[model samples]
Target: MAQESKPWYRSQTKVGVVLLAGSAILATVGGWLTGSISMANAVVALIAEVGALKLAFGIRDWPVINRNK
Candidate 1:
């Protein structure tokens, strides 16, 4: 039997979680400092956060995995 070492970049899950948490913190701080939460800003932030999470999680496209042989 043989074992292969995983690369550091393979820790997508951890990266995603960290990014998500950071996004949340940023959003909260922005809202607090501005004393107002703009819908547009919120939406943009949400989208960016989601995109980052997806990228961090190694999601490049739809379906998450290829089904075709």
Candidate 2:
């Protein structure tokens, strides 16, 4: 039996998680610095961090999306 090559994205997952965590921490701190961290602020931070990850790594497969169709 032969093993398949890992997808390119797997290599980037670690970096992505690190960046996501860093951004989340920064957001929390920024909110705390000004005042209390509201639920909406936390939600926005979560969404923005995920969006950043998607923009950075998810779009790498732009070609695959069209190719499979």
Candidate 3:
């Protein structure tokens, strides 16, 4: 029997994670290049961004609610 073909693109979570990581890395690099913000501030900002992303992706699908009850 023939094997089934795999998906061409990566999963949503994987893609999102990569994007988030890359964004943090880029921001850190930019901050370093500017030399305005300290390393500690950059680290804190990265942590906050990651935390927000986690909360966003952790959310579950909710059913629509009717207002006209």
Candidate 4:
């Protein structure tokens, strides 16, 4: 088996890392503005947080349903 050679600067992972940081900052600022974090806002932020995870670590392509072939 051979490994793929690529440049570090143009990596997709790098972009995802940047986006994750941005989302974290936004959530922090939002919580600060509201004086206290509430369940609703926390839920929304959680979703964004998970989405960022998917972006940073690419999701697997698993079939949603089983097909009877």
Candidate 5:
């Protein structure tokens, strides 16, 4: 699908990437400074968070038919 065809809010991949990057940095820095997570663990956590977000955003919303009802 073309980006121009999507709604304004739906076509926000750039914004999403920026938000994810910012959040990852904040989370890593906060946890590292507070001794909650080490630098290595912070890297792992960032990877997991990015993967989860990408998977979530990649899912397509399908319309379900009420055939059983």
Candidate 6:
């Protein structure tokens, strides 16, 4: 029997990478285009980055659903 491959969204590492990249772009754009960085914005960005990292590194084995085997 052939094994199935997991979807990209199911991979925590992939999700984390995308989240981190998005947060970085937001921070850079917010800082560069506005010429000002707010503490609130920085805090939010930090939270997102850290959360993504935590989710990626801290979790193993994705949750599965079953219908009576």
TM-scores of all candidate predictions against the true structure: 0.45, 0.42, 0.44, 0.41, 0.44, 0.43
Weakest lDDT window of 10 consecutive positions for candidate 3? 60-69
Q: Give the worst 10-residue stretch by lDDT in candidate 5.
A: 60-69
- How far in Å is the alpha carbon of 26 misplaced in model 5? 3.3
Q: Per-residue lDDT for 1-69 in model 6, tens only?
A: 954456657877787687776778677567856868776777776677767755664444243333321
Which parts of model 2 have CA positions greater than 4 angstroms off? 1-17, 20-35, 59-69
User: Model 3: which residue pairs collide?
Assistant: none
Q: Model 5, residue 69: displacement in angstroms?
A: 38
Candidate topping TM-score: 1
- lDDT string for model 1 (1-69, tens) is 843345534667655576676778587558856868776777777677766656654542324473431
CA lDDT for candidate 5: 0.64
Cα lDDT of model 2 by residue, 1-69, tens digit: 953445544766757665676778687768866778886777787677767656655564446664742
Ranking by lDDT: 2, 5, 6, 3, 1, 4
- Candidate 5 structure quality by residue, lDDT tens digits, 13-50: 74576577668878887998899999899888878876
| Better-scoring candidate (TM-score), 1 or 3 | 1
Sliding window of 10 residues with minimal summed lDDT for model 4: 60-69
What's the alpha carbon RMSD for model 3?
11.2
The model with the greatest lDDT is 2
Residue pairs clashing, model 5:
none
Model 2 TM-score, all chains together: 0.42
**Candidates 1 and 3: which is better by lDDT?**
3
The superposed Cα distance between candidate 5 and the true structure at residue 11, in angstroms, equals: 9.7
Show where candidate 3 strays beyond 4 Å: 1-25, 59-69
lDDT of 4 by residue, 1-69 (tens): 953444433778856676776778577667857868876776777677767755664443112332421
Candidate 5 error regions (>4 Å): 1-25, 59-69
Q: By the TM-score metric, which is better: model 1 or model 4?
A: 1
Angstrom error of the Cα, residue 23, model 6: value is 0.3
